[model samples]
Target: ASAKARLIDVFDLSDVQATYILDMPLRRLTKFSRIELEKESGELTTTIEELTAILDDDGNLRQVVSDELAAVGQQHATPRRTLLLEANASPAKSAVPLEVDDAPCIVLMSSTGLLARSADTEFDASADIARAAHDVIVSSVPATARGEIGLVTSAGRVLRLSVLDLPALPSVIGIPALSAGAPIGAFVDLPANEQALCLTTLDETGCIALATARGTVKRVVADTPGSKDSWEVIRLEDGDRVVGAVRLDDAAARTAELVLVTSDGQLLRFPATAVRPQGRAAGGMAGINLASGASVIAFGAFTPTDDAMLITIAGTTAALPGIDTGSMKVTPFAEYPAKGRATGGVRCHRFRSGEDLLTLAWVGNGPVRACSSSGVPVPLPTELGKRDATGVPVAAPVSHVAGSL
Candidate 1:
């Protein structure tokens, strides 16, 4: 009673509270709980001592922090994977060169509607390479790595494209494969039913000779205005479109002949001098006298000294295009004599049993490269047949053929 009175006096507690605290029963713990309780009590006592020492002096707090950091380093330290190096901080232009050196390259167009450039300028088309996708290069033009080239489209329009923006082909032996090239639509804003035909230079020294499906021929005067990126090279009729285009010079045209092959197996050959150069707005003159319902399929100029061979592939007119491989004939161009303009051409290929029209044709220097519609490499006849002979059935379907520059 006296001790309770002293506790109440020290804490200023009521007598009833002091009596309740004195009568409260203690909690009983199990064997496991007693050990846990003792552990918790020891941890709390140690924490309290450490905190009291930190409050007593600043050195104890620093020592605790240092011990914690050292524990963290021992627990989670790892070997370095990257090293820090010093570099000079300078202007961006000097730090990184943004200019491409002017090097000779070839701009190539695959038959599968792809465009790219390659640094393999000394490759020959006659040499064999691995048969990969887009193995056939239909058109190739010489250009610098940073120069510009022209893309001639079927709509008789030439679109200017920067060579630097073109995709570069990896260096390889023999002819380089252009499977990584971009599609023509990626760079040119082409319209529906119109596609790029070939490549040419945007210079003024040479002329652009082209032929239309309606037997029209014209040599466009290279009068490209300043800074003009696109221009119409020929004026077509209601249903006419350009089939082929080639760069020409006055010296080459004098000895060269413009050859046109119609779908009905008619081929007309005439000196390039017959068709004169005309302005862009002027409609072309008739270059061949076609039979009713016949249209020109191939038109190109070849020099007399060139080992030019006429390539014609005939397919069943009843079947869907590219569905059949058909037959191919390679006739030497020297066998065909020159004819006058506006005259019906001589028979170039005799039709087979089921063939009625030509599905593909080309007249240029051989040996040419052929590929299927799916960009697979195709083989051609190793023999040079007669001028008016029938072609043999090809081993595979050939959708396009190209001559090496």
Candidate 2:
């Protein structure tokens, strides 16, 4: 009782006269009148509103304060004029030009030449010691029909060079020959396997020459009456005979499945076994272009061109489209135009791995471009020069006169 009295005292409940009215009977409560009840109800409502206001203030006190300040400012402020400012933004510019480093220049022909001129600023020096001297030879000389100037190092090592990093030296050495008097033109070094293949022209025979590191030379000749062009040595795999070569003027190999683009632009294929011994195109049966000696016996179409066919060493043929050299777009092979119209028939050469085919193409005024099996073009550095009918670069070393990497 004492505690309850204290709580009531603290809460100020002693002013309520309803305690005695509640203890009276229902009839006696009616005597208290509705006026008193209404007054009490109004007091209870005010108390609840005050409690709610306190709770609201505690929950978001800072927000409530800020909102209250904003409300007060808005209620008392006057409108002001607004001003707008516009600034132009420009696109970012490159710091240098893409073609600046591609300027033409003379390359050094030997390590001694490169090392001697290493400190000189006359020519941009490349770090490829192996190709330094070869690049110099290829760039300084003029193209001649006699034969592409063979690049031999002071150590008597042959260089398979690429024009990509001109003024660079060759890093590889020692390739074989396809035949006697066959001049090796260009070649690539298989660094991983320590072997190399050279593209060369046989003496006066117009035969395809391939030299290997094993001191072996293999030759494939298209002795047919109408075959006057040379063959480009595309790639070398397996052995001296297991190589791939492509005709520069046409997209066909020597032997395997014969894919011939006729003078009228009609494509045709013949199997090695089905080739007639004495009939038309006889004794001219397509033979394996390289030395690996793999046999080709099937025929298939690789393109829609009635004149283009894919000839495999196994005698299989695939039809492809004819290359419209005049209308084709000329871009770096790596940056082949994806949106350009189909200008040339596609020729595919399957590598030993058989995953993809290497596609060589002739486009408008541009050198033949080699595309990967997946259609990604392998950009041949301009220094390599343009390919000839045999798919080999013409004997012009001057075309390789490019600056530096």
Candidate 3:
């Protein structure tokens, strides 16, 4: 008890700590207690000395902090795998800021009145041999993506169109269907009685020959001057409407001939020299002589060549259009000799029983294509026929025939 009291006073120990020390087994205390105490004292002395030296020197303390921070940063930073770039001035590259490049493109129209434009670069023709639905382009006009074109209507009105506003077709194989385009009716504000006939350029370099249902032919003189977007190209008489129109190279028209086919199996061909250029407001002169109840069904002016072809479709007047599957004949334009202006040239097609009028007719340079009124493509006969021979029966009615430009 006296020893415990002395130890407690010297160590400043509590009663429980003093009792725990005094109660230790004597042999264990003498052996392990000295070794353990000496080792612990040595470690504490080294740690205290090192800490006191670092605290005394400010530079040592800062160095330690910096080493720690650098280690942490090295461990957390991300690495780069690619190089970066910025625009420069060494090589001058002009800025092409156009929303749509002013590239050359072709505007195409389908028989169903749809219109679309496709890029002319790498314009492919390999897929044209294979026939498909909506593959027929009834009319195509060349224009730039940023230029303007003119659309000819059956009512003799020519309306200007912005090329940029047209729907663009993807780079495609074969003739594009123009299914992506809006209906022509949506683009042009036309009367219900009128319809768009074909496409033409608004430029003044060439002339456009037009034929009316009332047997009139007129050449829309080049150089249409006006800021007006739309104007009358021909002064159509009452109940008269344009049946066909085609662009003509003025130099070529000197040798070209105007062909007029009537509904009653009459065809007229005369040198385009027979007609004179007329102002936009001038009424046309007589183009073909038609029997009573017969009207001009088709007309075009073409320079006579071996490639020129005449296509005719025969049907009855009583049958609703495209309902009666008509007969078709493909004949060389040379089969019938040319006649004088305003004279019925010759009988182009002899009608079979129940067929009274020529439902469709075309005379121009071909590779021509045909389609039903509903836009389904119809194949033509491989055999050429005599000028006055009957046409071979077609599986379905052909409503339109168009030649490639």
Please, what are the lDDT tens digits per residue for candidate 3 over residues 1-405?
998998899999999999998899898788888999999999999999999998999999999889999999999973331222335526566688758988998888778787778885444444545665555666677889998888988989889888888888777665566556767766778888888888887777778888999799998787655698888989988899999887777687788889999898888899888999888989989988778999998988889777789999899879886588878899999998888888766999998988888988998877777888767788889999998999999978887777655
- Give the lowest summed-lDDT range of ten residues in model 2: 175-184
C-alpha lDDT score of every prediction, in listed order? 0.84, 0.28, 0.82
Superposed model 3: Cα runs more than 4 Å off: 1-98, 121-128
- Flag the better candidate by lDDT, 1 or 3: 1
- TM-score to true structure, per model: 0.73, 0.17, 0.72
Relative to the true structure, candidate 2 reaches a TM of 0.17
Q: If the candidates were sorted by their lDDT against the true structure, best first, what order would they fall in?
A: 1, 3, 2
Candidate 1 structure quality by residue, lDDT tens digits, 112-179: 88888888887765666666667677788888999999998899998999999988877777776666
User: RMSD (Cα, Å) of candidate 1?
Assistant: 19.6
Clashes of each: 0, 54, 0
Which 10-residue window in model 1 sums to the lowest lDDT? 78-87
Off by over 4 Å in 2: 1-169, 172-255, 273-325, 329-405
Best by TM-score: 1
**Considering summed lDDT, which 10 consecutive residues are worst modelled in model 3?**
78-87
